[model samples]
Target: MLDDNLRASRQTAHDRPDLQISFEFFPPKTDVMEEKFWDTVHRLAPLKPRFVSVTYGAGGSTRERTLRMVRRIKAETGVDAAAHLTCVGASRAEVDDVVRGYREAGINRIVAVRGDPPEGVGKPFVPHPEGYRNAIELVEGIRRIGDFDISVSAYPERHPQSPDWNNEIDNLKRKIDAGATRALTQMFFSNSDYLRYLDRARAAGITAPIVPGIQPIHSFRQIASFAARCGTAIPGWLAERFDGLDNDPETHALVAAAVAAEQVTELVDEGVTEFHIYTHNRSPLALALGRILGRRHEVAAVDAA
Candidate 1:
């Protein structure tokens, strides 16, 4: 009887036909990367994502490239572009000027973050003396500069350098209070972790829409290294799914698509209607997953060419 009830509940959650997805891309560092980035954008923008975000690099080193990509997307694509702005090493005046620059470029959304330092993750964070103190401070500054829509990050297993889980949640609340309108969690493997985080956020009076960030694990070695750096644990079972297929690229791609599609299906069963996919400037996997979930690509039908 309990099993039957649980099945019914899952079906009820997945029955909702309306769903939304967004994507995140990094600033291209070179000509070849730039071509890949734009082609990925062209391929996936047809799905009409809620908003496509371009990430500013650590210490804002990719600031100009990010802004250029964002402005071009705003001008050429049908999707809204959210420019990421980080508070790590820049002064308040410098950050403010960047905000104004976005406004002048006709971009109106910001993904505010307290970015990692040159020392990278697992290192202590030292706030810049003249910069905005944190992501919350940066969000507030954006609000003062313009009527921009702001989004902030949420950590499910807690940030690596955070003192405790409470401190992490408190920091999220502070960002929302400052001016953030939505939250996107760090990439996680299990649905239960995201659900529990949502439960705790509700308990703490957080009501903003929280989008789960999804990464399609395509390469085992690369993903494992990235998981270690971001503090996201890779379950043994998950690793086993791709085991022994390392020598077979075709089999690996098929396995990757199946696994990613299954993850999103399970998330939908858990009442998750929104997703944010990290596209490492490659969209075939994401595009395939979207088609699997019944999202239609609308690009060629409405093109000027």
Candidate 2:
């Protein structure tokens, strides 16, 4: 009965107008990776993600690579590009230069963040003192430099550094009040984590679309390591799903696709119309999920939007 009511609720929600979906990607670290990255780009471009983002790397380490990919997307792809800007290791002037470059390149969307400190996640964060203090500060600074559409990070399970969940919620409120138009959560595993986070967000009076971040898991070890750093809790059932497949790459791929497909389909069933995927530059997984979701993108539709 609840499933029926929930399904009916989604049908009603669908009538309310769907919010756009987008994805985030990291710049390739090698030549072979570069080829794979663009192949993924070409494959997903047809999906008409509202915008696709390139991740800003450690202490600005991936700055050049990320810039190269983002500019290329703006030049060659059918999708809008969002550049990630972070506050770790970069001063105001340094960040300003990057932001100005993106503007000149005709890219207008940004995912502003207080990036992980150069040391790494779980390490203490030392603000540049001169750089932005947090994501809110970064958003304000970006708004001042150029009229860019800025998005910030949201942690559905609470960020690693937050003293409390309310602190996390309050931080998000500050980001919104400071002008972030949307919030993309760090990648998560549980659908329930996302739904409950959204509910708490609304109750806290934060009205922006807190788009659930979906990471298509290709390797159990890698994803688990990532979830640990990012504060995403992997349920016991998920761990069980990947338990015995450590040595089987082919079966792992099949299982990975199935799990991601189920995640998104369930979210779609639960009334979540917008998605932001952390694609890690592997399009096959994201593509498999898209096809399962019935995405048959028409060029005419993309051009018209």
Candidate 3:
């Protein structure tokens, strides 16, 4: 049961009605996974997000699949779709072709990123000889292709490859100069980290919107492993919350919801009105967060394409 304080806070969130949201999804690799992916999409479509994004695989390995999923989401559900474009292994021409394709398809939003090295997160990143060297260059290249509302990545805890927080902030400013309209942070457990980063970003003269990325933890162990790779620190207290609950799925889900609700509500109090959720192609927890944010409404009828 929720405490009275939190229950009242949840009610306050439910009454606001003006919060904006977006969700991210990865392309499904198999038929069964595809079914599950659409189920997640259908369940959340009615909240009417700002735009939903489809993630690109490392080194553009899933380029075709990402484009297909983005297009399908737009055509079938009428929801605005943002395709993630990454600079990793592809040449400038190849990347340009993809950007032009998105323009022709009427998908105008892009999340430009300097993606993980093809080998994986912990490995050294080697840029393709003929490709853009980083996200800043990729953002410029996409701008050259067409008019796009571009978003780039921001690191609250600093990117794994960054030498320091200042370097990461400098890199983000460069991406903004290259035409990105917004920056979405890497997932962070502590709100203070994000608030500090925002202060530094403002001090550095970056005027674009820096959106926080929220991940609803479905599995603590799995997310902990991911945090290790992505440079996000898991607070010791958070780990304590999940302690000894490995076998308790129901309790785990409740705990996850409560933790996320607290995180979001606290951020909202700090004057944040827009959020980007990394859904990981699942729905229940994401939907719960939306409802907790006062986005509850009737479901829209959407047919999968």
Candidate 4:
């Protein structure tokens, strides 16, 4: 049922052992959600990701929860955890204090972002009168506080606010120049978009790793809605694949796995060796993706040996 080229690509990915992965999670708002969050974390921990990151909510609404979750994850799981820091609604001193908190907590890795305006994505981002103005300033502020391994956001398709590729790539360059060690792109459905963005970034002299962010289609409808909100284009073909399967959970799950499999394998074939998965606090699809990327549970492998 598979074409030879795609099948060979899958095999090549499985055989190559150099691939690296990371996961993103958000702070749980409720007790029930907290239980599910840990379940997801434990389920995917065996894959031994390079690091796991917890997101800070808009306007730092979940700041305390984000810090608590990241600390617990590192302390309990022994996995290096990164915290997301943003410049949306906090003054410079306040933001710097949070950075100090992360340093004190031993969270040395940070995902520095100019987060969505408190109003929401696509809304105008007005900096706090006394806060870091953008991601560049946020990265600089984080750098001043500690020697953090900072990561910033990139957009495969230009960000909604960026008027052109020049502006987009330049912004990325500035972020990296400030202190960011890596760039993690926004979730994109098209590999070509990512590849092209990479080429442009390279052309502009960005030498740091621009890791692709992979989003598993946990729910097609929900993901589509997110894509729309974030300005990510959904290909017609992708839409057609999920088209009449809204009520069929089983089939939808199968198709979701297949779609994500094809996407990552193709990237692997194109020489992409690093990935950052947005795990919306779920495990089945992320676990399936780990297997497809040739990662196995360390304990299971050791026991088998």
Local accuracy by lDDT, each model: 0.87, 0.84, 0.91, 0.93
Q: On residues 1-305, what C-alpha lDDT tens digit does candidate 4 reach at each position?
A: 99998677657667888999999999999999999999999999888999999999999999999999999998888888999999889999999999999999889999999999888989999999999999999998888887999999999999999999899999999999998999999999999999999999999999999999999998999999989999999999999999999999999999999999989988998999999999999999999999999887766345654
Q: Output candidate 4 Cα RMSD.
A: 2.9
Compared with the true structure, what per-residue lDDT tens digits does model 3 show for residues 155-210?
99998888988788899999999999999989999999999999999999999999
Preferred candidate (lDDT higher): 2 or 3: 3
**lDDT for model 4, on a 0 to 1 scale?**
0.93
Q: Worst ten-residue run, lDDT, model 2?
A: 10-19
Name the best candidate (by lDDT). 4
Candidate 2 residue 12 Cα shift, in angstroms, is 13
- What's model 3's overall lDDT? 0.91
- Ten-residue segment with the worst summed lDDT in candidate 4? 296-305
Q: List the residue pairs that clash in candidate 2.
A: none
Q: What lDDT tens digits, residue by residue, belong to model 1 across residues 131-226?
A: 998898899999999999999999888888888878988898989999899999898887778888898888889999989998887787788888
How far does residue 170 in candidate 4 sit from its true spot (Å)? 0.3
Which is better, 1 or 3, measured by lDDT? 3
| TM-scores of the candidates in the order shown | 0.93, 0.91, 0.94, 0.95
Ranking by TM-score: 4, 3, 1, 2
lDDT by residue (tens digit), candidate 2, 1-305: 57877666455323434545687889888899989888889989987778999998879999888888888997898589998999888788888888898888888999998889777888888888678778888888888888898889998888988999889899999999888889998888888888998998999999988888889988999999978877789899989889989999898898899899888877877778788888888888887766665564565445654
For candidate 2, give the lDDT of residue 268: 79
Candidate 4 regions with alpha-carbon error over 4 angstroms: 1-11, 299-305
Model 1 is weakest, by summed lDDT over 10 consecutive residues, at: 8-17
What TM-score number comes out for model 3? 0.94
